[model samples]
Structure formats: C-alpha cells, structure tokens
Target: MIGLEVSGGIWKATINRPEKANSLTAAMLTELAEIAERAGHEGARALVLTGAGRVFSAGADLEEAHAGLATNPVWERLSGAIAALPCLTIAALNGTVAGGAMGMVLACDLRVMVAGGKVFYPVMKLGFLPQPSDVPRLRSLVGPSRAAMILMAGQKITAEEAMSWGLIDRVVDAEALPDTVHALAADSVGASPAHATAIKRMIWA
Candidate 1:
C-alpha cells in the first residue's frame, strides 16, 4: 500500500492503506525503504513522506507485528535510508502517528502535521521497543523529559502539544496541508540536488 509520485525533482511517497489506519506491513515498509534509498540516487531535490487517510499510520499491522514484524530490520533500514538522504526530507503527517511508524517520521529533516493530529509511540504498552534510531531523534526533538513522557509514560500528545514541545514544525488544517508542504518544498525542489543537499547539511549541522 505505497504510492509514489515523482515530478520536477520532488518525490512524494504516500502510504495508501487507510482502511486499517494506514498500518504498515512488511512489504509496504520495504517499498518505503526502497523509495527513500532510490530518492538519494535518483536526483531528487526533495522527498516528502505522507499518508492517504485520516491517520498517518497506526504503526505496524497488528497481525504482522505478532508474526515477527515487530523486530524486523526493515524498520531500521527504512528510517536509516531516510536519515541518510542528502536531499531535504519532510514528513507531511496527514494525521496521527503511532508506534513503530514514528521511526520514519522522526528521521525526516522537517515535519508538518494537520490540525488535531496526535503523536505517540506505545512501545511500553505494546511490549515492543521503539525502533533503534528513533530514540535519539525523538529525544533530540522534544528533549529527554518530554520524550520520557511519551515513550515511558505512554502519553498521547496532541498536535498542539507536539508543536509547543518542538516536535511538529508546522500545524495547519487538513485542506491547507498540501499547500503547506508544497510551500516548504518549493525552494528545495527548484534547486539542484547538490545545492539542496549542501544547504540541508549546513542547517542540520
């Protein structure tokens, strides 16, 4: 359930399984990782990760998680691929982000969410550890204490709270999400890949 569109040096990947809250499966995660990896080599100046429904992702599909997807290396591969991209990466969070899905979202250089979207990782409750690389990124964005509030206390943070805590970069209504993402991506998309990469590294640095 992954859809990708490439135009004018911008790559937009969408998770298309909204019926199950866009929960990811092994194949879907693999495709996402492949897309991220390809974007790095395919001259993409900007890459946007987004979902196709009311929820970005409820994380891994429950059945698949029970069948060993919980500890799959693909999760790390996907997040790492996105993290290693030289071009700018943006997570256009269409809705709530939960569980293992937090990995890819946190790996992005920028995050913009729709209004009323919530963010949480229920690893403690679900008996699965958070994805390896996700921890430090999460900690970096929201700080140790707030990260503890979500990862340790299993707190569900709303979009507004996430913004104040430094998690979400921008929050806008659903209708405005596309425009917001487009605006954020325009400059990067228009630049050469190497130019965009250099600026991204400087900002990230």
Candidate 2:
C-alpha cells in the first residue's frame, strides 16, 4: 500500500509493505502519481519519499515487473511525475533501496541513506537499460565514473560507500534519519516557494 501524510508543510509518501520489503506493486505506483499530483497542486513546499519497513523498497515485484513494463507503464509515469515535482523532493532511505527503487531515489532532489543499508540499480540484470534522462541525474549525483560502475558493473554499494560516492547527501543512524530528513525538509520550505519551484524546474529541465 501507498500512504500519504501531510505534516508541518511536508508531504510524505510512504511505501507500506513490510511483508514484502516494501516492493512496489502496480497499484502503489498509480497511487504515488495521485499523491504527487494532489500535493503539487496543493502548493506543498517539500516532499519526502520513504517506506514503512526495514527496507526502503526492493524495487518492482519481480512477478509484476514485466507487466508493469508492457501493460501498466505505472513506473515511468509516476517516476516522471516525481522527478518533475515543483517542490524539493527528499528521499529518506531508511533501509535497503535496490533495483527499480533506485529510479525513485534518483528522482528526488536530495537523498539520505541510513547506515548499514545499501542501494544498487541493476537494470542490466533484468536485461534492460535505464532511460536516457536518468543517466544525467545519476551522473550529477555520483559522477560519471561511479554511475558507470553502478549501471555497467552493477556494483551494490553500502550506504556508507554510497555517501562517500556522493549518491546520498548524508548518512545517519537509522533512528536519527527521520528527524534529520524532517529538519532538512523544513529548511527547504523556509525558502520562498516561488524560488524553490523555479530552481526545481530549471534543475530538472
């Protein structure tokens, strides 16, 4: 399930599926789009993407992945909306983030990964390649060499290493992650909404 919580000017969308490591199903992706649209139009200044389990997200459920690619197309549409969100989008990586989950992280303007967690985008293992637009974002976050290693070599980096590689803006203990993210989101909202929106549009463009 996907859940939305609006508090203190932050719109947080959480992936709730602890039993399945928060792996996203098709429905959840659609719900994400709906939440993003509503929050964007509602004039939210910040957004936090997270999960309600030990793992942030394991990416697409393997059984549903092919159908998602062919029939549903939820992944593309929802992720695109996230990337184009008018506000500052923060990814609070409380736990493991992998596979298709990496796309969502890349969509965010900033990412914070918890200690001991890991993140890897292994689209090559699925016999596919990431879309062209994702390439630049990944490069901007981690530089071309590390991005190439992730996509081409499929290297899975620990959160500490990911922080060192610049994939994540900060690394913190799991217990402290939420508060830290909330504080960051609050700071983002302190800026003029118009300026933030313009900057977001330009950066994503």
Q: Say which candidate scores most in TM-score.
A: 1
Worst 10 residues of 2 by lDDT: 67-76
Off by over 4 Å in 2: 68-72, 199-205
lDDT of 1: 0.94
| CA shift of 168, model 2, Å | 0.6
Q: For every candidate structure, what is the RMSD over all alpha carbons to the true structure, in angstroms?
A: 0.8, 2.0
Q: Tens digits of per-residue lDDT for model 1 on 93-128?
A: 999999999999999999999999999999999999
The digit string of per-residue lDDT tens for model 2 on 73-183 reads 566676687877889999999899987777778888889988889888888778766755568878988899999888889988998898888888899998999899988
| Deviation of model 2 at 71, angstroms | 7.9
- How high is the lDDT of residue 82 in model 1? 95
Q: Which pairs, if any, clash in model 2?
A: none
> In model 1, which runs have C-alpha deviations exceeding 4 angstroms?
none
